[model samples]
Target: MVRPKEFDERVALTAAMQVFWEKGYEATSIGDLTERMQIARPSLYATFGGKKELFETALRAYVELSLTYVENKLRSMPSVKASFLAYFQGVIEGSGGSNPDFGCLCVNTMVELAPHEPVFAQITEEFEARLTELFRKSIEGGIQSGELPDQLNPSSIARVLTLTAIGLTVTMKMKPSPSRVEHVAAEILTLLE
Candidate 1:
């Protein structure tokens, strides 16, 4: 009979995610995960299958954490445009300081492994689709509230904004200057107004 796991999965996953986020999937070793997770190798394998499986868990955790922020912006902000601006501002502000090497995990995975890994490609696509949907919904809300121009196409504009955000995220890895990043974000936000 299998025994119930004693360790906190969420805590372990958070540590694992941090390790994977700091180091790309290709570069993260099993030793790294085990060391970061503070678990035995046998226990890690038993609970999470293998390095790939653990990395997938970490990816899911990252998405969950990100979505929490997105959901908060969507539900609580006074206006759709304001919520989106806040969201992008958060992204710009968050991608700074000591960990500039690690950009958005989803974007990093797309650049590093999506071309060769079908599973990672699908995961990345899902993340992009969800982000697009969030922007599309915000655009639709803006139209309904008469905040955006009537003729504007929410779907296309959302795609553009999403792509622009992704570009900014990837670019942050190369250029950590807050002013430059904010400038690019300002241009993107101009489309909304």
Candidate 2:
């Protein structure tokens, strides 16, 4: 009879995700994953295939969780503008204003691995497209509700906002001055007007 696994896969995957989020794919070693995941190398291979596969799995989980967080934040306020402001503000503040900022896992992957790795490129690209769609829907709602000008182009504005978010997230990784970052975010929100 086959033996049952001793470790919890979800908990192990979460640990691996944290390791990857802290150290990019290249920088992370199998030893690092095994250690953080608290599983032996054989168990790692048996459970997750290998480092590349594990990274892919971890990244997909991060993508889903990130999108859910964004969707929930966007829907939190009745006013679309307020919702967006709060979303951007949450990004600026960095995980309830307590945790050390890692920027964003998807954006980090886009910068670190997407250009050379087709799989990562596709994953990150899909993430951006989804975020843009979310923004587009919210903007369309604003237009329908008469909160935004009818002539404004939702697609164009959504793309710009997505790019702005990407740029802001990358900038935040460098730990710039808080006031300057907030100023830049405020200026970006003016695009909604």
Candidate 3:
């Protein structure tokens, strides 16, 4: 019988995700993953199959956690407008924390690999669609609660927020200024009126 490896899978995957997020998919090498993961090639292959599989796994993990976070926060918050602003504030706080230019791991994968990879394109599209739905739900809740005007379109505002998120992610990677992002987010939230 074969014995399982001693390393922690969660730690390894998180480390690999960070590397991929920082350097991107095409730029991240097997050596880099192994180095960051603190595991040998055989162990990595045994655990995740290979680099592409590992990257896919990492992307899925990131998406799941991030989506859950967004969902939980938006759902629990009292004000729809405050929920969206808090979401952007989370983004700003995260961006300024560790690797300043880390941006978003899933967003990075989408921009770097989705164009040439159908699977990645689909995954990215689904992620964006779900995000849009979250925003739409919040907007709808706001309308029902008399917090927002009746004439406002939830679908349209949701799409706009989704688009703004993509742009903001890229901008963070380039500039990584929390204040600037926060200012832009505050301005964007004014549309809630």
Candidate 4:
């Protein structure tokens, strides 16, 4: 017979996500996960497998949450331009304008682990592709509605916006001037015109 889990897996995974988000995969230790997750070492292993597997699971959760947020934000405004603006502003003012406090977990993973780890590379790449598709779909809606120029290539513009977002997320890690980052975001939106 098997015993029931003492703690909520979702809650424990969220805690582990925060730990991995703050400290990259290499920097985070099993002790850090167990301590932050409030679980014993054996329980951590039994529940989440090894540290790498736990990180992968945590990353997937983050990606799902992030994609949902992006989709909702993109659809929140009727105007595609306004939607993009809101999205960029949200990035700049993340949950009280402290987004740079940790930077994006997926982007951070891309920089820290993707280069050396094929698994991470694939995960981050899939994230980027999915994000780009969301942007592309939003842009297509604008074109269809006659809000944006029909000649504009949604695919190309989406790629540019996605890359810009990734770059901005990485730059935010440097704690640069908020105004400057906002300026870059503004310039990116002009691609729609």
Worst 10-residue lDDT window for candidate 3 reads: 91-100
The local distance difference test score of model 1 is 0.80
RMSD of 4: 1.5
TM-score of 4: 0.95
Steric clashes per prediction: 0, 0, 0, 1
Name the runs in model 4 displaced over 4 angstroms.
Answer: 96-98
* TM-scores for candidates 1 onward, in order: 0.90, 0.95, 0.90, 0.95
Clashing pairs in 2: none
Between candidates 2 and 3, the one scoring higher on lDDT is 2
For 1-193, candidate 4 gives per-residue lDDT tens digits of: 8999999999999999999988888899999999999999999999999999999999999998898899999999979999998888777667422356688889999999999999989999999999999999999999999999999999999999999888877877787876677676577789999
Model 1 lDDT per residue over 120-185, tens place? 898889988898888898888889989888888889998998788788778777866666776655
Quickly count the clashes in candidate 4. Answer: 1
Prediction RMSDs, each to the true structure: 2.3, 1.5, 2.1, 1.5
Clashing pairs in 1: none
User: Each prediction's Cα lDDT score?
Assistant: 0.80, 0.89, 0.84, 0.89
Residue ranges of candidate 1 with Cα displaced over 4 Å: 1-3, 95-101
Query: Residue 96's C-alpha lDDT in candidate 4?
Result: 29
* Candidate 2 Cα outliers beyond 4 Å, as residue runs: 96-100
Descending-lDDT candidate ranking: 4, 2, 3, 1
Error of 4 at 93 (Å): 1.6
User: Comparing candidate 2 with candidate 3, which one achieves the higher TM-score?
Assistant: 2
Better of 1 and 2 by lDDT: 2
